[model samples]
Structures are given as C-alpha cells and as structure tokens.
Target: GRALGEDYEVRAAATAEEGLAAVEADPEAVDLVLLDIRMPGRDGFWLLDRLREGFPNLPVVMVTAYGDTETAIEAMKRGAYDYLVKPFDVAHVRALIEAARKQRALTRSAVSLEPDAPSPGDRIIGNSPAMVEVYKRIGQIAATTLPCLITGETGTGKELVARALVQYGPRAEKPFLVVDCAAIPKDLLESELFGYEEGAFTGARKGGKLGKFELAHGGTLFLDEIAEIPLALQSKLLRVLQDGTFQRVGGTEEIRADVRVIAATCADLEARVAAGAFRADLFYRINVGRIHLPPLRERRGDIPALVRYFVQKHGAAVGRPVTGVSEDLLRALQARPWPGNVRELENEIRRLLASTRGEVLAAEIPPACPGEDAACGELRSLAARALEEGGEGAFHRFVARAEASLIAEALERTGGNVSAAARLLGITRLTLRKKAEEYGIRVPDPDA
Candidate 1:
C-alpha cells in the first residue's frame, strides 16, 4: 500500500472470507483487490468465485509464491485480473493496478448503439437498418457458447462484434484474449497457439510456456484473420473445437481448455475452400454461427451518427474540442465511398481534428479521385464522342482507359506508394501492380 503511494487507498483483509465480506459490504468503495491464493479458510478460488458473482467488473490480482505462477495464470483464466509473484517489484504491481483499473472502467461502460449519443469512452454508435440487424444477431447469439465466425470487409468492426459477444456472455468475468493469425509467422503460429514442452526444440525455455489456449481456458479466444491459418494447423484447431482437447506441441499429454472461440476474417472462405486452400469440413464447423457485417458504403444512412461519434471521441483526443460538425462537412463525408469503412472515416476525422482551428469543423472535401474535378468534363466529352463513333469495342476501350486513368491518379496521389495506392483504389497491391504494368505506368521502387 505504501509502495503504491498516497494516490491509492489500500484496504487489507486477513482472510478470504473477511475479504469477500468487505467487498460485499461496500463494493463501490473498492477499485482493486489483491488476494493471496493460499489464504486460510475457503481458499482464494472460493473467494474469487464469490467476488466474481457479486462484482464481475471489479479487478482482482492474485498473489502467489515464486513457483506458483502456473496457478496464478489459472486464476487469471478463471476471472482474476492479474497475478503478482512473491518478491515482485513494487513498480510492476503499480502498473498492473493501473491497467486493471482502466480495463475495469471500459468493461463497465458497456457498448452503446444510441445514434449520435455523446460518450466519453468507447461505444458502438450506429442505428441504420443494417447496423440494427447486426445488433440483433449479436443479441441472439452473444449469450451462447456457440463457435461464432464474423465475416466482413476490413475495418467493418468484426473485432468489436467479437468483444460484444464476450461482454454479454456467461464468460464475461473470464479472460478474453485475441490472436491475429496473419500477424504471426506461419512457422511459429502452431507453437504460439498450442505451446510446447521444455526441450521440445532448440532455444526452448527451461519451463515450457503456456499457450493462449490454456491461458484463455474458461473464457473467450478471438482469432482474427482466421482464413490466414495454414492448412496443416486447421486440423489441430478442428480437434479443439470438436472435443475441447489438444496436446502441447511435441508433448504426449492431451490438455483441455473450455474456451468459446470467435473467429473473424475478411477473406471469402468459400472461395478458399473451392481453391483447395482451406479445408471444407473445417469451414463448415466454424460456419455454424456466422455473422456478416455490411460495409460502410452499404449503410450510408448511418454516416451522420458515425461522424458525430468520431468528432466527439477524437476531438478531445486531439486536444481540439470542436463544438460540432457542419452540415456541409457531414454531407461531404456521406458523399465519398469509404473503401476502408469506419476505420478510414475515424482516421480522416483524426486528421481533420489535428489541424482544425475553429469552433465548428468545416474543411474542404477533397475529390474522391485525384484530379477528378478537372477530368470529369473531358471524360464526359470523350464518352459522347465514342458513342457517336459507335465502334464495336468502344465500351471496353472506354472502361480500360478510365481504369488506367484512376490507377495512375491513385499512384500519383500516394507519391508512387503502391500499397497506399492499392488501398485508395480498393484493390490488392498485386492487382494494382499488374494493372500499372499493363498500362505502362511506372511506380517507384517499393523499397524506396
């Protein structure tokens, strides 16, 4: 308590029963709990359950001896906020307390979908018909432990839906862990998910580490970019989903973890299966409870609400507190095709807030395509002339010319950055490069 300084008021309890009683008596007064696992009478686990039942939002950090880190980890899987090993650094404890406080606050805030509602923290913030359908699906399956698969275009809030599932489910009190399969290298992903025994391979730790599966036992595990999981690893994942059992890499013992798995992907798994890149059976297993999120372009009616939410959220964040958005600004936002969806809209809001000077946000809306304002007139004239000439391949030729022009403009806008241009053009970098080459357009070296 002294180590945490005068900023925190510490309350100590002699026994597990006494601690639970104190919290039950005045739950609102307590922000954090540090319980020793070996407390006399009823044990920490018993007290942990009592605490969870009463105050699922409260953060509890388990205290353990040097060799009991595994038990501490087990405690975390079973709803403890974190653990402190004996003789732990005072600074580390302080950091853990701070983090737990922040997370607890966020969990308690909950996600709100009220249109144009001002929130000081995180909220879902959409009320269009498509978004309403999305919410309905979330409400329907969030309470069940069904294996859920969230499919959407990138930046369409797939992870947000996944978190909502964890928040509303019976395992809300337990740990919620996320793994991005695409971010991890393919070679290491197997061991990353399943763990490995000591001496399993070169440079293995003396005490084999626990994998996310074991760590997330009795809770939720969110696997983003699910389609990126390699074919060989798919079978192992299928086994766990089938029987809730898996062995550590290179280990004989079969370990079991009761985890609710939620997966998200932007890729079309049906195409992957057709191409023989993904297993058909595995796809069907995860597809049992699927939720597809509509892209932002399909739900432009929700743009005002989204813009309002982002303005309030990012305005204070950027230290430029604008009173409100202009009608002109809102219309301009709704006019563009947000290829990157909500994520892109939020980024643009942040960019505007960084340089915004006035009380009301009003800025020039750039053309969707660079130089589009200047070229639209000429393009219309060309189209009319092509129609008058009535050539057999005129339509195809016009489309090719327009596509080439857009590709060149996107590249120019991004200063020859192929990846950025591809994102702007709503196509893959590979496709952009092929089109650029076919059109005899030169792009700067990627390394440059």
Candidate 2:
C-alpha cells in the first residue's frame, strides 16, 4: 500500500520522531510527506509547523481521524498541501502526491517565479528568440515597480507573465491578487475593486468588504481583461492611478491606496482607445512595461516540452498512469494549429491523460481534419462512402461495416487487451466485448 504503485520512492517512518530525523538528515530528500495526525509523541500539527518553518516549500499531506471543516481550513492555512481523512483510499493519497509534486515542480521552475535566475528566461522552457525576448523583458520589468501591461491571444498565458513580474521583483514578499474585469459583473466590479461600506448597496455584506485594491495594499493587483472595465468605472480607476487614492462605494473618506497594478488584455487596447471604449490615459499608463506573448503555433518547438509537462502533471494527479507517449502522438500534436494556444494544449494533454488506460498512442489523439469537427471525422467518411456506393440501406451497411472494422483493428493491434483497445476506440471495455460478440468478431488471445 505504501509503494504508491512503484513510480514513487516511498519512505516509511513509524513515528513523528523518525520522520523528523529522516527529513533533517537530508532536508531535500522528500518531495512530499504524508504525516499522520495521530502519531505518538508530538502530533502532526506540531510536526507540520516545524517542517513548514524548516522547509517552507516542501509539500505536506496531513492525514487525520478527526476530520472537519475547521480542521481542513486550519491545515491548509498551516501550509498543508492537502488533507486526507482516516478512511481515505490509497488512490486519493496518490492523487494528492501528484498534486504536491506538480506544485513543487512549478515552484522550482525559473521562468515565471524564480528570483535571482542565472540567465534571461532561465526557467521558461523554450529557446525561441521570441520567448527569449519575453524573458528579457520580464527580467527588466521585475527590476522596478512600474505598472506592466501584458497582451497576448487568449490562453497565451498572460497571467503567467504577470506572475513572473511579481515573483522576481521587489514585491516578491507581498500579497499578489487578481481581478478579471471580464468575468465579474460590471455593476459590482467597482465595489469588488474598492471596498463598500455597510448599507451602501443591497446584498452588501455586514460591516464592510475590503476590495482587491485595499487587500493588495502592499503587494500587486493583476487586472485581467483590462479593456472590459466599464467606461464609467474607468474614471475612478484613473483617479486611483493618478493619486493612489479612492473612496468606498458610499463613503466620503478617501482611502490612500498603495498597490501596484499589472493589467492584461487579449484585445487591442489601442484599437479600443481609438474606438472610444477604453480610456487612453489608463491604456498608456499600464502600457509602460509591456510584454506580448506569442501564440503556441508560433512556438512549435515548445510543444513537445509542454506536452511532457502536462502528461506528467495530470497523469500523477488523476491516477491514470501512462507508461510513455508514442512518437506518432508527438507528431500529431506538433502538426495541429492550436487556436486556443497553450491553454488548449494543456487541456488536451490533461484530457488524454485522464482518459488513457495504458501507453498513449497516436490513435488516441483527435485527428486534425481541416474544416470539420474531429469528433465527426468517422461520420464524414461514412457519409462519403454511402454517396460512393448508393443503394437501399447503403448507409446502414456502411455504418455496420465501419464499426466492425474499427473494433477488429483495435483488438488486433492491442493483442486483445480489452482495456487498451477500448481506450483506443474511445469506448468502455465491456461495450467493446459486447460489440465483438454481436459482430461475431474473432479476437485473438495474447498467448495464442
């Protein structure tokens, strides 16, 4: 049970003392520690505090018999990566381990958050000149407290650039908050950015609420989709930027704001300004330290690295282990035009990892059919076949023949490994077996 299926190097400690000793002997030996709360001598909470102070970046998973909402919240605040109740399954523990490892890996990566990185974009994965320029720009911006504007196509990772500025900059030690101007309702956005006094508006919380600007007083506020901010609210935003001061929604006292703003937009703010939708002055102010991210298609060399990262990241977390990815799969990934950019690629890998039952293959990836839905490729082929050989029930014969051929091919290639074949055909193993029986298909045994 402790082996975590052989992929992880599990270290056992009968007691908290032994665990602490193991950690102390080689402080960096453990990537994740699963400490039980009911251990003899000092409890897990005490050990948690010690480990947190000693290795601040270490991911810890706390297991406890006394699970509750308050306990869970407290454990999280104490820097526990995740918590498992007494009766939790081993699968849950494995998932938590994956999450922890991914978290730790992201923390150590130099590109976005690594302070004192040796070279420009040292942590970023790509060596493309465009990416290299972005890295250099990020380093330059990180040296000062200038308001930065990051512009890119949707899903090009604008937030990542914003994060790099904060993590490698003077504001590294302070809180960094984000507000999506497009996601939140415009009517409530002002109050959300700036606090509102009690009874100032209906549905307002008791006492008052501290806004993102006030909460991020000594840190950074990342405003995503800056172009979406309503024209009426832009004046207030301008005033805040102008003198670093703003009042509550219904109050007269001006709150002296002292927060740095990093704005991002996928839209052309200059076009918006010219169209009289966005404030020109605010656009220019935030545009001081600018960084534009290239779409994934323009950075094709980075695709392989990103795919590996996502596969490892999601496979571990979701418990769908893939031994390796086929070269054919890599080629399929590289050839596509990712309209959704890096975010799309990450989601695709994650979805593939979650669905695959064994080694990932080229057949598992969605085919790149131009001007047609990948899901309907088979249907399109069948339709064309029906047109080629027209007769009564020709469509029915085509569907049945195609289905039988697909099932036969999948079983043949997998050596009758039902689960693997099922994954390849994107169906359940039981469904495949039933279909084989219905079609009287002869599936060969592995040792035949």
Off by over 4 Å in 1: 1-120, 370-448
lDDT of 1 by residue, 268-353 (tens): 67765644446888898888788899878789987887777778777777665577788988999998777667777887888888
lDDT by residue for model 2 over 221-265, one digit each (tens)?
Answer: 999978768778898998887889999998889898788999998
lDDT of each: 0.76, 0.74
What would the C-alpha RMSD of candidate 1 be, to one decimal place? Answer: 19.0
Of the candidates shown, which would achieve the greatest lDDT relative to the real structure?
Answer: 1
Model 2 compared with the native: what TM-score? 0.56
Clashing residue pairs in all predictions, respectively, total 0, 1
**C-alpha-based local distance difference test score of model 1:** 0.76
